[model samples]
Target chain A: MRLSLGPLLYQWSRDAIEAFYAERMADPVDVVYLGETVCAKRRSLATDDWLALGRELAGAGKQVVISTLALVQAGSELATVRRLCRNGEFLVEANDMGAVRLLADAGLPFVGGASLNLYNVAALRLLRGRGMVRWVPPLELSRDDLGDLLGEARRAGIVLETELFAFGRVPLACSARCFTARHVGRPKDRCEIVCEDYPEGLPMASQEGEPLFTLNGVQTQSGAVQHLLGHGGALAELGVEILRLSPQPAHMGEIIGRYRAALDGACAETAVDRWVTAPLCDGFFRGAPGMAAAPDP
Target chain B: MKLVCPAGNLPMLKAAVGAGADAVYLGFRDDTNARHFAGLNFSDGSARRAVAHAHERGCEVYVAINTYPRPAGWRRWQRAVDTAADLGVDALILADLGVLDYAARRHPGVRLHLSVQGSATNSEALRFYADAFGVERAVLPRVLSMAQVERLCEDSPVELEVFGFGSLCVMVEGRCLLSAWTTGESPNTEGACSPARAVRWVESAGGTEVRLNDVLIDRFAPGENAGYPVVCKGRFTVNGATYHALEEPTSLNTLELLPALARAGVAAVKIEGRQRSVAYVDKVVRVWREALDTCRRSPEAYTPRSEWMATLASLSEGAQTTLGAYDRPWQ
Candidate 1:
C-alpha cells in the first residue's frame, strides 16, 4: 500500500521544519502534504518555502501536496488560499468548504482532508464531483464504516481513491475556542504562539491522572497515538489506496518503514508490537468502541 | 424578527406556539435529528398533530433531519425527510450534505434551514450550500463574534440566524467527539450530546460531582448548582491542576445584546434546548420576543429589564448566563 504523510499539525523551528522534509526526501513515503494545517500565525516556513520544498520532495520521487489551514477565518485567509491554489506545482487538500470552493472555482483538483467530515457515500459523491479526487475518511470511522463505504462504492459503479489514517495520534475534534491557547491564558488572537512549544501537543489528563486527550490549539487529539502497524493485513484487504502517517517529533521514518514492512507481510504481530508503544486499537475499524483495543472482546 | 424555537415534545411544541414562537422545530423519535434524547422527540402521530397544531395557530412547523446518517440506517432518515415533505412542514433544518442532497432531490420545494450543528463557520461554506442546494437560512455557530457575524452577512446570500440564548458549547458545533470519546453514541451521527444514560451524579465529601461514562466531568459544593457533565465543559487536569478549563456551567444570554446583534445583520434570533420545560421555553421566548420588539422600536434606546434577566437566570443551565462571545470581555 502507498504511504502518505499528512500535513504538519504543529509549529517547529524553520530549520528543523525544512530538515524534516529534507530528510524525508530519501524516505519511503509516497505522498507528502506540506503547509500550516493548524494555526495561521505559524510562519516558520513561508508559503514560498513550502512550494520550494514541494518541488524538492517531488524531485525526490515523493508526490507533494500543499494543504490549507483547517480554519480559514477572514479575507486574509481567503487570499492565502488563492495563493496556495495558484502555485499549480501540487494538489491542495481543502480542509474547509470555503477552501473547497476556492479550489473548485480556480479549476484545481483537490484531496478531501479529514476535517470536512465525509461520513457517507453521498457526501463523498458530492465532494468528488467538486474536484475531491481522493478522500481522507473522517477521523472516527471504524473498519465496519470502511466496509460499508467500500460496499457503497462497489454498488455505485465508481471507485474513489481512499486514504486511511493509519498512524499517529487521532485528531478528535477542532473548536473555535483554542484550548491550548486558553490553557496558556491568552486570547486566541494573541495566543503568543504557545502551541509552538508543545511539539506533540500538551497532554491533558483526568483528575485521576488517566491520559485522555491532547490539546493542540483548536484541535483535540487522542492521548494515545493511534497505531495501525498490527492491522496492515486487514487494511490491505479492505481496499485502502493509501495509509496516512502524521508527522511527530522523532522516529517518524521508522514508523513509516514499519507500516511498509507490515503491509508486505514480512513481520509478525510480535515484530510490529516492538514498533508500537501501546496495545492495538483498531476497534474503530471493526465497528466497536473507538477506545477499545484490538483482539476485540 | 422570526423566532425558531425547538420542541422535543408535543407539549413544548404547543407551548412554543402559545408563546408566540414563529416556528417550532422538532425531530423524529429516531436518530434522524439532533436532540435525539431517549423518550423525547415525537411519534409519527405526535409529529402530525404537532405540525397541525402549530399551523392552525399560524406558527410554522419545521422538522429537524440534521444529523449525518450512518450507512445502512438511512431509510428511517429518508422516511423522516419524506414524511416532513409530505406533511407540508414549513421547513426542514438540515446539517449533513447527504441529507441535503436527498431533500433537495426528493422535496425540492421544502424550505431548508441550516442547523447550527452543521457548523457553517463562515460565509463561503454557507454560500456553498446556497449554491449547491437552495438553503434559505443558516443557524450561525455560537463561536462567531458579532463583528464576524456582520462580515458573514456581507458575503453570503442566505439569511443569517444567530443564537439569542442557550447552552454555550465552547467547542466548535457539529465537529465534536466528546460524546464519541466518552459514550459510544455521538451528536454527529446520533444527534444526542451527553446522553443521560451515560451520566451519573454523585455526592462526595467535597461536593456533588457529575460523571459521564465513568469519567468525572464536574464537582459542586453543597448549596451550589452543578451543570450537566458534558465532556467539553468538564473539569480536567493539565499541568497538575484541575479546573473547569472549558466553560463554567453557564447558559448563553444574548438577550441583553439583541439590538447589537440585530444591527449586525442577523435576520433572526434562535434559542436552544428542545428538551426544556414549556414554562422555561415560554418565558425565554416571550422575554426575547419582547426584547426584539423593543429593539425594533428604537435600537439604541432599548433597555433590557432586570425581571427578564432574573427569569433568564432562573431558567438557565447553572443559574448563570453571559452574553456568550457577544462581548468578548465576558467570553
Candidate 2:
C-alpha cells in the first residue's frame, strides 16, 4: 500500500505551510492532499495559492488532490467548494455531499473523503457511477468492518481505491461552536483567529490531569495518536490501497519514513511505538473503544 | 408549521397524537435507529398499532432507520425499511446512503425524509439528497445558525425540519465519535451514545462519580444534581480551568424561536426525546402545538409566553434550557 499525506486540519502561517510542502518534495508519500478541511476562516493559504502549490507539486512528479471543507455551513463555504471542484487543473477530494454533487454534475472523477459516510456496497457503486475513483471509509470503521465492505464491493464489480487513516490523533467530533475560541472565552466570529496560536491544537484533559482530547477550532480530536504501523501488513492484506497520515507540526518526515520501512516488511521492534509524542492507540481496529491500545501482534 | 414529536412506544405515540402532534416519529425495538436505549422503541406489533393509531387521529408515523449500517447489518436496515413500509408508516427517516438507495429502489411509493444524522447543513447537500433519493424533507442538524437555517429553508429543494426541543447534542449528529472513543458505542455505528451498559454511577467521597467504561466523565458535589454521562457534556480542564469544556448539560428549547421559524418557511418543528416518558412527550407536544397554532394564526402579533418556557424548563435536561445555536451569541 502507498503512503498518502492527508489534508492539513490545523491553522498555520502561509510561510510555514509553504516551507513544509517544499520539504515534502523529497518525502516517500505518493499522494499529497492540499487545502484546508477544518474551519473556513483559516485563510493562511488562499484558493489561488493552493492551486499554485498543487501545480508545483504535480510538476515535481507528485500526485496532488485538493480537499474541500468537511463542514460547509455558509454559502461562501459552498462557493469555496465549487471553486475547488472547478479548478480543472487537479482532482478534488469531496468531503461533503455538496462537493460530491458539484464534481458528479461536472462529470469529474473525484476522491471521496472519510466524512462522506460511505459504509456499504450500493453507496460505493452509486458514487462510482457518479465518477468517484477513490474513497476513504469513515474513521470509525474497524479492520473487520472494512474487510467485509471491501469484500462486498469486489463482489459487486465496483473498483474503489481504499485509503485508511493510519496515523495521528483521530478527529472525534465537530461542532458549530468553536471550542478553541470558546476555551479563551471568545465567540467564534469575534475571536481574532486564535487557532493559529495552537499549531497542534490545545489539549483538553480529564479533571485528574490525564490528556483526553485536543480541541481544534470546531473539531475535537483524540488525545492518543492512532498508530497503525504495527498493522501495516494486515492493512495491505485487507486490500487497502493507501495509508493516510495526518499532518502534524513536528517529526512528520520521520513518521513517514518509519511507516515506509514498516510497509517494506520491516518488523516493528518496539521502537516504532515511540514515534509519536502521544500515547499510541489501535483498539478501534480491534473493535473496542478507540482510546484503548493493544499490543502489536 | 407541522409539529413532529418522538414516541418510544404505542402509549407515547397515542399520547403525542392526542396532544396534537401532526406527525410522530419512532424506531423499531433494535439498533436500527439513533435512540437505541434499553427498554425503548417499538416491537413489530407495537409499530403496526402505532401507524394505525396515528392514521386514525389524522397524524402520520415516521420510522427512524437513521443509523449507518455496516456490511454485517446492511440487510437488517433494509428489512427495517421494508417492515416500516409494510406497516403503512407515512415516511422513513434515514441517514445512510445505501439504505436510502435500497428504500428508494425497493419501496418507491413510500415517502422518504432525511434524518438529522444525515448532517446536510447547506442547500447544495440538500439538493444532492433530493436528486439522489427523492428525499421530501430533511431534519436540520443542530449546528446551523438561525440565519443559515433561514437561507437554507429559502433555497432548499426539499422541505426543512428544525429541532424544537430536547437534550442538546453539542457536536453535529452522525459526525461525532466521543462516545465510541470512550465506550465502543456511537450514534452512527452502534445507534447509541454512552450506552447504558457501559455507564456506572458510583457514590464517592466527593459525590456521585459517573464513569463510562472506566473513564471518569464527571463527578458531582453533594446535591449538585448529576446528569446523564454523555461524553461531550462532561467536565474537563482546559488551560488549567475545569469546566464544561464542550458544552454544559442543558436542553435545546426552541419554543421561543417558533415565530421566526414559521416566518422562515420551515415546514416542521421536531421535538427530540425518544427515550422520554409518554407524559413528557404529551406535555412537550401540547406546548408546541399551542405555540405553532398561535404563530400561524397571527404571525405579526405573536409573542413567546413565560408559561410555555416554564413548562418546558420544568421537563428539560438539567432542569434548564437554552436556545442553542438559534440565538447563540458566539455564532
Predicted structure with the largest TM-score when compared to the true one = 2
Lowest-lDDT window of 10 residues in candidate 1 chain B?
B322-331
Please state how well chain A of candidate 2 matches the true chain A, as a TM-score: 0.97
Query: Where is the poorest 10-residue window by lDDT in model 1 chain A?
Result: A270-279
Best by lDDT: 2
Instruction: Please give, for residues A118-190, the per-residue lDDT of candidate 1 as tens digits.
Output: 7888888888788888888877777777778778876986567889887777777776667778887888778
Q: What is the TM-score of chain A alone in each candidate?
A: 0.93, 0.97
What candidate 1 gets wrong by more than 4 Å, as runs, is A269-280, A295-297, B329-331
Cα lDDT of all candidates, in order? 0.80, 0.90
lDDT of 1 at A51: 93
Q: What CA RMSD would you report for each candidate?
A: 2.0, 1.2
lDDT per residue, candidate 2, A150-199, as tens digits? 99898889988999999989998889989999988898888789999999
